[model samples]
Target: MIVVTTPTGQIGSQLVHRLLDQDKEVRVIVRDASRLEDTVRERVETVEGSHDEPGVLDEALPGAEALFWLVPPSRQAPSVREYYLGFARVGAAAVARHGVGHVVGVSSAGHGWPTPAGVLSAAFAMDAELGASGAAYRALSMPFYMENLLGQLDAIRGPGAFHLTCAGDLPLASIATRDIAGVAADLLTDLSWTGQRNLPVFGPDRLTPDGMAEVISQELGRPVTYRRMSMDDYASLLRSRGAGDQQVKDMTEAFAAQDHGIYDADWATAEPTSTDFRTWCREVLRPAADA
Candidate 1:
């Protein structure tokens, strides 16, 4: 059986679908299993709880042959790194105790870099703990999600401009969450458990935020401009939106890292995705415009 964490999330939802398609016995850990679609709920066993809950993972790990792990974004953590590493240690202990055969963890690109990227420190920490686990592990390192552009959708639909804090062009190896989940499904079904391996799941093309504006323009039938904001200005905007100062600082630093070419390393080639940005915009964003 394969056990999945964060099954209600974008990638996790897709992964569950892929696993069910293969007729694999699947177990997913979620705070509310009833929130999933009827099909997903019917196809998999559901374990209720958050990843942060003590002893919850241990209860979920036993008898599972493989585990797909991810730490979802959280605003409540006082220190993001500490929160991430704590989850990592708990997951590692659970895997060790259960003798799970393999673990495929979703991590970020540039986790191999020694110089950490501020609050994204969790990605690096996750990689380390997953590697330390004696189970067969695959750390799927990914670039920014194309869905991150969902934040710019409102401006694309309205009279205003799409804004970013990144200076110059951020040539992101933008990938679809579906593609990442497909790869995870492949790893879970196709092979026997091995030791740790880092896999970069880059999409076929690289795109900057400015390039994204072009895509939005083509789909929306309007000219969308990409405007870069100063780091402080972006931080201030986030604060005005009710974000704490630390969260604002974290976002600002992440943007600064992007500006300085932090994640410019060689991205690993991933399996082809049928749903590129154009297809995604047509199917997902267009409908969102009506709502």
Candidate 2:
């Protein structure tokens, strides 16, 4: 059995489906089972509770051979890094106790940069804690998800462009969540690789926000642009969207790092890729826009 966390989330949900398609015995820990479809709940062993709790994994991890770890976003988190580390500590203890052999975690780029990483720091810390546990670990390192654009669906459809705080002309690393999930599912299914490793999952093409808008415009047969907003304006927009104070702060730091070209190195050391932004827009965003 493989234990999957965040079973109802975008990537986790897709990962569970892929695992099930491979006929792997699947179990999931979710706070609300109602959020899952009836087919998923019926097929997988369900543990309804917060995965960050002390005893939650004790019940979920035993008899499970592999684990898919993802730290779900918490808007109201007091400190993003602390909240993430708290859960990682719990998960590492449980993995050690349960003797799980393999772990595939959703991680990010920028392993040891000189700047503030915002929430990406949590992923790095979790990778270290889990890797030291002696389990065969694969840190599925990814960049800014192209799926993040879905959140700005209204802006894309209304203003015919996407907004960001970083330079629009500078290319940055990015990937599709489906590709992440697909690679993760493949890793979780096989126990062939041992020890810890960071697998980069940057998408096929390196495109700037402006370049992305151009591809999306071509795909949709309409004009779309990349609008670079001021950092203060970006923070205000996030706040107006009901984001918590900590979220505002973290995102502000993230944008600052982006503005400084911190993640630029990710493109230099990118991994083999499959889907690019244009394909992603055609396959994913176009439908979202149509909806």
What are the models' TM-scores?
A: 0.92, 0.94
The best candidate by TM-score is 2
Question: Candidate 2's residue-wise lDDT over 43-149, tens digit each?
Answer: 99999898888688999998989999999987778788888888888898899999999999898877776877777766788889888877889888888899999
Candidate no. 1 TM-score? 0.92
Candidate 1, position 82, lDDT: 80
Q: What lDDT tens digits, residue by residue, belong to model 1 across residues 1-291?
A: 899999989899989988898899999899998899997898788889987665787778878889899998887766667877888888887888888889999987675565547565667787788778778888887766777767776776786467777743766566788889988999999767577777878677667777877887788777877888888788888788788776776667666765665556736445545667777767777677657
* Global lDDT of each candidate: 0.78, 0.86
Root-mean-square deviation (CA) per prediction: 2.0, 1.6
lDDT of 1 at 248: 72
